[model samples]
Target: MSDADAAVGAEVDVDLDFGDDGLVPAVAQDAETGEVLMLAYATREALSRSLETGRAHYYSRSRDELWEKGATSGHTQELREVRVDCDGDALLYLVDQSGGACHTGYRSCFYRRADGSVVGDQVFDPDDVY
Candidate 1:
């Protein structure tokens, strides 16, 4: 399925190049504002679930399982589009996000600067959750 098809929760029929580990890098972006929200890995199942549910799903390498983006924190990423790079090795997920994407309570995972300064104010407090 194309990104437009995925946005409407249709089955994706595009080619994908999964790595040897059976995973592919997936980048999540803000659908309306064009902000990069986070980077994660997704298995085929994850991709299928995202398309089936209209929500983002990713394979957690650290946890060794599929996870829905906002299952715990309520910071769900509503899938809007899914794009495959020309090489088919990477994916871009455009989403309508709710709440902060970062576990640290930031709107994005890339909230820190290389110089050790924060880019902007944090949107939420991690202490309230896990």
Candidate 2:
């Protein structure tokens, strides 16, 4: 790590920002392509791991553990930048993605049919991804 980045990482206080549920919103965007890929949540360890490893990591509230996005599915988000909102309750992740960001074989999780009411079109079955 560069000296500047190491300094910033060391000073980041992740515990100061988590919500009551111990979660902070993490917005993932494509670093090179500039597309928003998905949104998730990160707990303290997840945030720390992301900073240390330069990979997108998050907390799965349902599973109650730190998870690296796409870890099992062979798609990964390589962290480019992580920014906190003014309130520190939310985070923006700039990443370089490998493979589809969504388990459904799409580049982003935001893929959905826009009928008048916002319908979803499932492109790939969940069984195929996990």
Clashes of each: 2, 0
TM-score, structure 1 vs. true? 0.92
Q: Tell me the deviation in Å of residue 88 in model 2.
A: 0.7
Candidate 1 regions exceeding 4 Å error are 1-6
True-vs-predicted CA distance for residue 86, candidate 2, Å:
1.0
Alpha-carbon shift of residue 58 in model 2 (angstroms):
0.4
Query: In model 2, what are the clashing residue pairs, if there are any?
Result: none
What TM-score, over all chains together, does every model reach? 0.92, 0.79
Report the C-alpha lDDT of model 2 over 1-130, residue by residue, as the tens digit: 6422432353475535786788889999988778788888998788888888777899987888889987898678877778888888898888878877777777878877565443333445567888
Q: For residue 97, give model 2's deviation from the true position in Å.
A: 0.5
Q: Write the per-residue lDDT of candidate 1 for residues 1-130, one digit (tens) a residue.
A: 6443456666777789898999999999998888888999999999989988889999999999999998999999989889999988899999988998889999999888899898855888999867
* Candidate topping TM-score: 1
